[model samples]
Target chain A: MLSVMETSRTHDDREREAALQQLQDIERAQAATWLDHPATPWWWAPYFAVWSGALVLSVGYLPGWGSALGNLALVAASGFLIGYHRRHRGTWPTGDIPRELHRPLWMLLVGAGVVMAAATAIGFLVSVWVSAVVTDVLAGLLVWRYERDYARAAERARRRLP
Target chain B: MSAPPEAGHEAAPAPLADLDPVLTAPKRLAFMAVLASSASTDFSFLRRHLGVSDSDLSKQASALESAGYLTVTKDGRGRGGTTTFKITKEGRRAFERHRDTLRALLG
Candidate 1:
């Protein structure tokens, strides 16, 4: 004779078809969630690009002697922004660093500050054109490096997500 | 018709009649649905997308683990530990069964 539990198990088998239908409904709902956030990637690129371009153009337009000093300031600002954005996104690449090995991000800020000061002093004591060229080169390098780093970080984040 | 003496005794509790929907609660179901559609997901990725608390996420994950629905692995190091989760074959079957049951009920 079949027990009550055994009978219920048989009923469960009969219900299997219904279970599959519900799963499809759930899957459709989940897919809709992705569509809702579709504009996000398209918006981020143009916004960031405009801000970066403005920063470069502002410093690049300075007079011969002032150009280098302006470029150095731009570099420092760009580095700070890059660090800030990384920290904001919670994607800072310090995950591998041990707690004891951790150093304040202030170190990066300090290094940038020193570069700016050196550029300013050189502009005052030597030729402005020479200072401008050096500062612009340094600024351009910092910005380029940060852009690459940020792109790599974004890619890693994408790969980690479902 | 007269019932037997054994029939007069208390009947066994029904094997969870509403198991389909209950098993696939919105968040857990959503988690599995996402995993089913994707290759895998990491801890922070799921956390940010699902907008659930760490403890809540852990609890839901534990429930799914007990059901043999997912495999969760912890990789990387320190406070920034990386956790990866993937749906299991048994989980896929359970999800399908749950959906089938729901469809039958609706019909």
Candidate 2:
């Protein structure tokens, strides 16, 4: 009788462990979704491009009222993109960015900074218009790289799930 | 008489007993896991991720809704519609408690 009771308890423990493991797998899968997300691959590029353009206008690449119009365009475009993403993705990721994203995000910041610095130095020697175009390229290249890295990380996580 | 507890002998209630019963179902637990990270999630996304039929997902979601653990918003009807779920403060608290209990038990 005592042995039977022990065996039952052991079985219960095994079941509990399995459930906990499933819970963990579910959490990981969700984390992957959060990392890669639906709008990640294509949505960011246009937004970043507009942002880069806005930055150029703000920094005197374009003179007078053109800068104000650029700013207005940025705001409107951002609003539309955000709304579209919220509808398409069907979720708002309110949590802190995942740890796996740290590398990509850091790379984005560093790459943008380097591009800005180079553009500034070259602007002195070359034309400001050329430097502004370089900034635009910065947004495109950095977004592409970030998406690639994010997809890779998300895939690795999916593979790890049972 | 019962024997004395030995070095390897166990004498404790099951750890699962401490968990919130509302989250015991794997699908429901997984559902909450997804919703907990995001502010809101749609029904189709939950259905695909949980690998459950629409009816099954609906049942489980209704249960959570009934428990006041989540709120469901339905827009329109038929194919063009959307159903979205958002976790409540109560749900988040319960999920956190359940996670803490699981960790304590596993440790």
Candidate 3:
């Protein structure tokens, strides 16, 4: 009897079909829930906006000490974000680390810093403010790029859903 | 992953034998679905995510363990230890086969 039952559905094919559909519905809902909930609860947009705004505003109008303090704070925040991400990388259901994520953004920041440092050491060569403007522009571009990259990754993940 | 059923399964409903009983239960299936997608997950998080009571979750989880579908590790010592559950290779294969067979049945 068990073998026969295993080989075929019970006589009520309609009822069996209904049960199958309900199971599929439940399964899909479960998949969708897990899909949306990544291990790392990344809330990037607002944090990026607030910090970047403060960074640029401080560089533009804050007193020298105030600007320096603001920059220091921003650097600390960046460090904290990296640390938090690393903490979750291996331990949680976040899966593999996206090795390519924000690569361009990090490189841009590094390149901008290197160029700015060289410009300042040359003794009033082009203009002091020019270097700051260039770096600030690069940072703004990074903010934009990060958002775009995150969106792309999210869409790619959605395709794997049930 | 186990090879999906050959083309004939599309016309006839997949045999019940094609399904993995351990993966068929709603809660257990949900558990495997979550674990299959990750390296590991905290016990508490998985239970909450499955929306099952603690004892119920523990029972289903233990059944999976006994079936060689998953492994449960109790972190630290005995009581009050944090538990972490990870799906084994067999579990991953079983889940993929079950999922594919399920799709075939639905068709």
Candidate 4:
């Protein structure tokens, strides 16, 4: 009698565990779907390119008033971008950055930093505006690369699901 | 699951009786789990993710909505119409409880 009860309990446990696993997979698959895009549209790279370049130019070369105005413009553009992303995607990602995206996101930040450092170095040799343009181009390329990496990483995560 | 359980959940598991009844159904549980990860999800997207027919998804969604676990918003009509679902605060709390119960059961 005791063994029979234990066996039944174990069976129930297994069934419950399986159900739990399925629910978890559902959550993860949804997360993967969200991560697949994560607010990045085709023009995301170009928008950041112009925005970052303008920011650099404003801080690096503009007078006080011009820099303030540039900051205002940047804020407005950012707000617009957020609205556009939410409207088009019909979802707002709101959670810790998924582990799958961590590496690519870190690489993007590091690449941006390296490019900015290089741009600053070049500014000393060439014109500041020229450095801004160069930074703009490089930033766009880095963002594009990051987008591809994000897509690949998200795809790998989706493949592993279930 | 895309990830494993974190290590700190190794304590004595809770009893199965603690599970949320509203989340007992597989499709409903999965639906809430998905919603817990996003601010709002569209109806079509939920249907695709849940692999349910439009009517079936609507039925499940309506059940949850009636339970005050989620809110549904509709825009436009017919072909151009869009419906979106957002989990309510109560829903999130319930899901957390259900998930914790599941984790306990696993342990």
The CA lDDT at A12 in model 1 is 57
Instruction: Give the root-mean-square deviation of each candidate in angstroms.
Output: 17.0, 3.5, 9.7, 6.9
Q: Write the per-residue lDDT of candidate 3 for residues B1-107, one digit (tens) a residue.
A: 97777543334567768889887677888788777766677666676677788899999999999999998877687666678788899988998888777666666
User: Which candidate gets the maximum lDDT versus the true structure?
Assistant: 4
Selected candidate, larger lDDT, 2 vs 4: 4
The runs of at least 3 residues in candidate 3 whose Cα sits more than 4 Å from the true structure, single-residue gaps closed, are A1-91, A94-162, B1-11, B77-80
**TM-score (all chains, Cα) for each model:** 0.39, 0.82, 0.51, 0.78
Q: Ten residues in a row with the worst lDDT in model 4 chain B?
A: B4-13
lDDT of 4 by residue, B1-107 (tens): 45665453333456767888888888898788778878887876677777899999999998999889999999899988889889999999998888877776766
On residues A34-146, what C-alpha lDDT tens digit does candidate 2 reach at each position? Answer: 65356464547766865775676566565678778777777787788787787777777776565666777788889888877877776777877776777777777788888
TM, chain A, every candidate: 0.35, 0.74, 0.39, 0.80
Enumerate clash totals for all models, in the order shown. 16, 0, 0, 0
Ranking by lDDT: 4, 2, 3, 1
Q: What is the interface RMSD of each candidate, in Å?
A: 9.7, 2.5, 4.8, 2.5
Off by over 4 Å in 2: A35-47, A62-66, A96-99, A116-127, B1-8, B11-15, B75-78
lDDT of 4 by residue, A1-162 (tens): 678767866877776777577656656745744664445667889988898788778877899999999889889999999887766766676755567778898999899889989888878888789888998999889989998998887777666664
* TM-score of model 4's chain A: 0.80
What would you estimate as the lDDT of candidate 1?
0.56
Docking class of 1: incorrect
The per-model lDDT (C-alpha) reads 0.56, 0.75, 0.63, 0.79
For candidate 4, what is the TM-score? 0.78
